[model samples]
Target: RLGELASLSYGLAMTVVAMKTVTPEPAESGALVARLETLSNAIERLPRVIPPRGKGEASAAPPPCDLQDQIAALTSQMEDVVAGGPIERREKAPEQAEKGEVKKKKGGFFVSGAFSDPAYSRFALKGTAAVMISYLTYTLLDWPGIHTAMLTCFIVSLTTVGETVQKLFLRIAGCLVGALLGIVSIVFILPDTTSITSLVVLVGLVTLPAAWIAVGKPTVSYIGFQIAFALYLCILQGAEPGFDLVVARDRVIGILFGDLVVYLIFTRIFPVSTLTQLRLDLDKLIRQCRDVVKTKAAFDPAAGAIQEAGRAYATLETASANLAAYGYETFHSGNRRLRAQANKLAIKALRGFVNALAVVAAFPPPQGDAEKSEALRQLLLHAEMNLQTLAFSLAAPFDVSSGALVDSMPPALSPDDEPSPQISALEALMARLNNVKMTLFHYRRLLHTEAGAYE
Candidate 1:
C-alpha cells in the first residue's frame, strides 16, 4: 500500500509541474496538451493495487505506461519550451535592454548606513573599548574568570550616564550579597559533601530563589544572576574535598573592576543627560499627538501615529526614571525636584494625548451635524496649534510666562447633546483634553521657575 501511494503521489506532483511549465501555444499540435491533461486526470483516478503479502506471494504487475518515462518526457518538453520559446525570449528582452543602460555598482565588503548611524556607532565604539579594557586588565591581574569580567561590563552599561551609574550601584550591591551567600553555603552547608547527588540537590535548592528574583524587577534581576554566579564559582572551582573561598573572591573583584571600568567610560566620556533625552522624547510625542489630532477620524487611529506615540511614551518614562537617579547629585540638587515635577506632568499630558487620540479614532466625525462638526474642527485646530508651540518650547529653552493666559488655555470641546451614555465618551475626551492643558500649564511654570533659578 505504501509503495502504491508513493507512486501515485509522484505522478500527481509531476503532472502539476508539467501542466504549469508546458504550453500548447508554441507546440506543433494543441491536441498534445489536451491528451496530457486527460492522462493526468486518469492517473489521479487510478486505484492503488496492493500485492498480497503471504510467504512467496507474487508481486502485482506495474501500470501499462511507465510513469517515470512519462515524467522525463514532460520535463524534456518543458526544457525545450524554456530554451527557445517566445515567452522566454520576451521575458529576457527587457533585461537585455536595461543591462546596457544601467551600470551596477561593484559589490564589496563594507559597512552600510544602518551600522554607521550615531545610535549604534556611538555605543558600539564605547562598548568595544570597555570590553577590551576589562579583558586586558583582568588578564594582567591573572584573574580566574576574565570572561565574566568582560561580560559584566556589557551587563552594567546603559545608554545614558545616570542609568549606567544606577545599574552599576545595583550590580555592586547585588554581587556583594551574592558573594556572602556563597561564602555561607561553602563554610556551613557543603563542608563535607563528597557525594555528587547531595551536592546537586543542594545547589538546585539554593538556586531556586535566585531564579525567582532573576525573573522579577529589572533593577534587581542582575543581582539574582550574580548571586548564582558567585555560588557556582565558590562551589564548583578546585577538585579537592571542597572548593576554596579564593575563587569567589577573584570573581567578585573582577565584577567590581568591570563595573568601575564601564562607569568611567560611559559616565565621564560624553555622558548622556536624562533631561536632554526627555526633551527630545517629549518633542517627538508632541509632534505625533499634533499629527493624530489633525488627521481625520477613521475606522481606527493612524498606525504610524499610535506607534510613534507608544515609543515616545516609553522613552520619556525611561528618561524620567533615570533622571530620578540624579536627585542624589550634589550639584544643582534643588532643580531635581522641579525636573521631577515637570516630568510627572509631561507624562500625564502624554497619557491624555494618547487617550484623546483613542477617542478621536473611536467616534468619527458626526456627519450631518454642521454645528458639532465645525466646533470639533475648531477645537482640533486650536489643540494642534497649542501643541506645536509646546513642542517648540521643549526643543528650545524659552520664557513660558510671556504667553497670554487665554492662549494657554484649552479649547472647549463641549458636545451639544444632552447628558446620556451615548455621548459620555465624548464628554470624557473633552475632560482629558482639559487635564492635558492643566498639566502643560504646570509643566511650563516649572520650566520657567527652573530657568529663573539658574539665572
Candidate 2:
C-alpha cells in the first residue's frame, strides 16, 4: 500500500510538471485574457429591465424584441442565416426507445438451415437414396456380400449425374476386366501357388497397366481405380489357400447394383450436363488468362497467374474431353457433332494462346529499350482488351441470323519482321501476341461458320 501511494504521488507530480511545461506563458496569453475580460464587462454593462410587480400576479417573460431581446433575436437570426436553414430538431424518446429495444433471435431447430445449401442438399439426398436402395436390393435378394454394394454406391457418387454415370460405366467395365485378369493369373499362370514371389508378380502385372491408364486422362482415371480395387478383392481375399472366385463374383454383382441405383436417382433429379460444366470451366480459363495478361503488363508478380493458368488448362481439358465423351454417349439435338467440332477447335486455339502467353511471360522486357518496351506494353494491353471482349461474347449465346461471330471481334494484329538483339524480346513478345490474336480470330471464325452451318 505504501509503494502504491508513492507511485500515485509520483504520477501526480509528473502530470503537474507536464501541464506547466505545455501551458502558454502569462505574457504570451495576456492579449487573449484581456479580450475575454473586456467582453465579460461589456456583457455585464448591457441593460436588464425588471418586470413591474402586481398584487398576486406572476412575472411574465420580457417581450421578444427589447434591447436584450433584440440582441438575442438578432443572434438567433444570424445563426439560422449561417446554417442556411432552421436548426435541426431531434427527439430524445425515439432515440431512447430504439436503444432500449432488444432484437429477437431464432433458436432451437433453426440451426438446420446452416446445412441446407441447395447444392449440398442435392448431394446428400442423392447419396442417401443410392445407398438405401442398394442395401435394400441386396437384402431382398439375399446376396452373400451386401457391404461391397453399399461401399461402391459411396465411391462412385460424383458432383453431377453425367459424371457419375460415366464413372459407373467405367467402373463396371474395369471390374469385369480385372476379375478376368485375376482369374487367369491364379488358374493358368500360377495355379495353387502360395509363394510370395508369384503373388507379387501377379499383383505387379495387373497394377502396372491400371496405373498407366489412371495417370493418362482425368475422365477415364476411375476405370484404373476400379480395376485395382477388383484385382485386390479377387487376389487378396485371405492368406489361406490361393484365390477366391466367389469374392470377385459377389463384388461385381454389388458394383452393378450400386451403379443401377445411382443412375436412377441421378438421372431423374437435379441432373447437370457435362457440356454446361465445360462452359463454366472455359469461362474460368478465359478469366484466368485475362488476369495473366493484365498482371504481366502491369509488371506485377506472375506466380499466381502461372498457377491459375495451369489449373484452368487442366480443368478445361478434362471438361472438354468429358463433354465430348458424354455427348457421344447420349442423344444430343441440333447438330451435336458440329458443336463438338467447334468446341474442340476452340479448345485447341485456347491451348495455343496459353502456350504462347506462357512463353512470352517467361522472359521480361529487356532493359535499355524504353520505346520498344512501351510499344510491347501497349500491344499487350490491347490484346488483353480484345481477350476480354472475346470472353464476353463466348459467354453469350451466338446467333448466325444476327451476324457472324468474327464480324463483332476486334481486328487481329500483324507481326513485324525479326529484330536485332536490343529489341529481340519485344519483337518476340509482339509475334506471340499476334499469334494469340490470330488464334482468337480463327476461333471466332469457327464459331461463326458452325453457327451458319447449323442455321
Candidate 3:
C-alpha cells in the first residue's frame, strides 16, 4: 500500500516540474545604458565645475550659484570619500569623543582592539541554545543513549553561516513538516520499498502547495527545500528504527539546532556586507537613471532619474527588511553598533534618493543649448559621485567623521533658466525641488545622529 502511494505522488511532481511557468523578473538592461551615458557626460562637464588647474585643499561644498570651482571641489571630495580616501581618521565618533574608547572596553572582542566578526563567537550562542535543549531533553526523559545521542555540530556550519533568518526559519519549518509527513506515509501507506505510483502522488501533493506558497510569499526558496526534504524523509528515514514519536521529535530538534548554529554564526563573524555588492545595487540604479536620459538627448534626464529613484526607494526598503531579519536571528554584542549605523545610513540614503531623483528630473534639455547640457552633465556627475559615497559607506563598517555622511545634491536647471517649447509642469517641479534639499538634509542628519548615539 505504501509503495503504490509513494509512486503516485512522485509522478504528479514530475508533471509540475515539466511545466515552466514563473513570473518575469525585473529587468536591469534598460537602466544600464542610461547610467553609462550620463556618467560619460558627467565626466566631460567636471572641468567646468572645478578650477581647471587649481592646486589647494578641497572646499566643503559649492556656493549656490555659478560657482563652478566650488562645485568641482565638492564633487572631488565626494569621489574621495567613496574611494575610502586613505582613512585619515580625523573625525571621532561622538561616543569616543565623549567617553573615550579605552574606558568603554567591556566584554568586547577585538583585532588590535578593533571589534570585528568572528565565526566562533557568532555560532557560540547557538551552540548554547542547542546543547542546553538537548541536555535538558535527555536529562528529563532519559531517552536511551541520551549521553551519546547527537552532540556534535555539523561540518556544514561554517559554510551556511550568515544566511537570513527568514530563509533559515522557512527551511526549518519545511524540513520538519516534510519529515513528519514523510514518516507518516512510510509507516501507513508505503510499507513496501518498491512502489512507484504512490510515491508520485505524494510528491505532487507536497510540491503543489509548496510551489504556490513559495511563489506568493516574500521568501520563497524554502519551498524548494520543503518537498525535497519531504521526499528524503518519507522514503529514506523509514529505515531508522526507534520509538516513532520520540525519533521524529529528535530529528526536528536536530534540524532546528543546525539552523540556529548557522544563524548565530553569521551574525557574529565580522559580518561585513561586500563593497562590491553594494556597488552593484547602486550601479543598477545608476544604469536605470541613464536609460531614461538616453530616450532623447534633448529630453531632460530628470524624468529618468525620478524613475530610478523609485527603484532606489524599493531597494532601501529591501535593505531595511534584511536588517530586521538579522536583528531577529541572534543577539551579538559587537554587531550592535554596526547595525545602528547601517540602519541610519539606509534611511538617509532613501531621503537623498527621492530628492536627487526629483531634482535631476526637473532639468531641461538646454534647448539645443550645448552649454546648458554641459552644466547639467556636471551636476549629474556630482550627484552620481555623492551616490557612490553613500553606497560605499553602507558596504563597510567604518567610522564616519563630522559631516561625513551629509551631502548636498546638485541643483535642478529651471524652466526660466532655459529657452524652449515651454512646459509649465516641468517648471513647477523645479520650484518644488528647491526646498527639497533642506528636507533631505534634515533626514540625513537624523540618521547620522541615530548612528552616532549607538556608536
TM-scores, all models, native as reference? 0.60, 0.61, 0.42
Instruction: Give the distance in Å from residue 94's predicted Cα in candidate 3 to where it truly belongs.
Output: 39
- Model 3, runs deviating above 4 Å: 1-167, 183-195, 213-218, 235-247, 260-368, 388-455
Q: Which stretches of candidate 1 lie over 4 Å from their true place?
A: 1-125, 143-147, 192-197, 238-242, 296-345, 356-360, 364-368, 400-455
User: What are the lDDT figures for the candidates, one per model?
Assistant: 0.57, 0.58, 0.44
Candidate 1 per-residue lDDT over residues 62-147, each given as its tens digit: 32222233343443333222223221121111211243685444466754564667856777778899999988887777765645
lDDT of 3 by residue, 198-251 (tens): 666766776777677667645455555664654454454444422355455555
Q: Write the per-residue lDDT of candidate 2 for residues 249-341, one digit (tens) a residue.
A: 787778777878887777777765555666566667766667667765775433333444455567667756665545433533465565556
Better of 1 and 3 by lDDT: 1
Best by TM-score: 2
Q: Candidate 2 or 3, higher TM-score?
A: 2
Model 2 Cα shift for residue 365 (angstroms): 3.2
Q: How should the candidates be ordered by lDDT, best one leading?
A: 2, 1, 3
Q: For model 2, give the 10-residue run with minimal summed lDDT.
A: 88-97
- True lDDT of residue 212, candidate 1: 92
